[model samples]
Target: MALIGIISRELGNLTFLVSLDLGSNKFHGNLPQEMANLHRLKVLDLSFNSFSGEVPSWFGFLHQLQALNLGNNSFTGSIPSSFYNMPKLETLNLKFNSIEGQIPKVIGSLINLRVLNLIGNKLVGFIPTSLSNASRLETLEISYN
Candidate 1:
């Protein structure tokens, strides 16, 4: 249910705030680390794909990013801790991946956070107190009791 004929370039002329939805596809292989070049990316959806490997750390470089979806992929590894630097990030949907490790205390850095869904993953450790500081937070779904 997977193949590699994916649209591999979006940065050639993309400038304005952009949104991409490539969910429910049969894409296989790593998410191209080139997305960070879309410095103006405001929303991105890559859910329900066959993407493997670690999510690139450069995602934190997208200062204009407002929402991001990397759910239901085969991504394996700890979430890049640098994600806390995206000061404008509002909605983050990373619900179903192979992501392990504690939700970093840095998540509190996302002051504009509305939804933080890390539910149904292999994460472990105590919930970080930093998350509570997000007064704007609307939802936090992680399977840890």
Candidate 2:
């Protein structure tokens, strides 16, 4: 258990941040809610860590977000519906977590999405046929329950 302290809120002061990568660290616990203040963020990668707790819904506030990766963590719960509001999103990866539930139908709203990975979770439900609406989608990986 190489875990460190929880994510700090000091990150919120970086209002001009465009890319934030904190993957493969020992950081544990839920992401600070202040992360929602990064309105200019384009790429956010927090993968391969020990982060736990439900994915936050305030992620929708990052309207400029293009790539988001929160994979291989301890996250438990469903994907947030507010994610649909991110019209600029291109890559969304939540693979290898504890998330369980249906893939939201509104996922189709991410028309610019290219890669969607949700593998190795406890999720159970039909693959949303609405995904067909994501015209730009190139790769979709969802396997290993």
Candidate 3:
């Protein structure tokens, strides 16, 4: 059976952690702010969970994050503008959520980004022209807004 419950703030104590995959669980509630302390994280997947609340802006603090997947959750609100700070990010998956707002143009600043999946959200407006600046992007799924 999948795990169910709120993540402990103590999880943030793993300062040397590199990859954390807690996807496909029943975890609900907002992520612990202390998770922002995972500065060395490279891959973080919290998809297919019951987590709600805004995607935390502190995610930007994980500068070493290369792939992040928060798809198929109950999260609401716009993609955090702070995401642009993840300069090394390669894959970002935020599909199948209740998130609203236009995809930020600053997304282009993630020059190393390769996959961006936003297939099922409430995003409106034209795809930002600055996306062309993401020359390394190979897979972009934005269907069913």
Say which candidate scores most in lDDT. Answer: 3
lDDT by residue (tens digit), candidate 3, 4-108:
999999999999999999999899999999999999999999999999999899999999999999999988999998999999999999999998999999999
TM-score of 1: 0.89
Using all chains and alpha carbons, the TM-scores for the candidates as numbered come to: 0.89, 0.96, 0.98
The residue-by-residue lDDT of candidate 1 on 1-145, one tens digit each, is: 3434554656424656478777878876776666667788888888888888887788898888899898888777887888987999999988888888878888898999999988778899888898888889998888731
Clashing pairs in 2: none
Q: Scored by Cα lDDT, where does model 2 land?
A: 0.93
Tens-digit lDDT track for model 2 on 36-84? Answer: 9999999999999989999999999999999999999999999999999
Worst 10 residues of 1 by lDDT: 3-12
lDDT of 1 at 109: 89
After superposition, candidate 1 runs with Cα above 4 Å error: 1-13
Q: Which of the predicted structures, 2 or 3, would earn the higher lDDT when compared with the native?
A: 3
Scored by CA lDDT, what does every candidate get?
0.81, 0.93, 0.96
Candidate 1 or 3, higher TM-score?
A: 3
Order by TM-score, highest first: 3, 2, 1
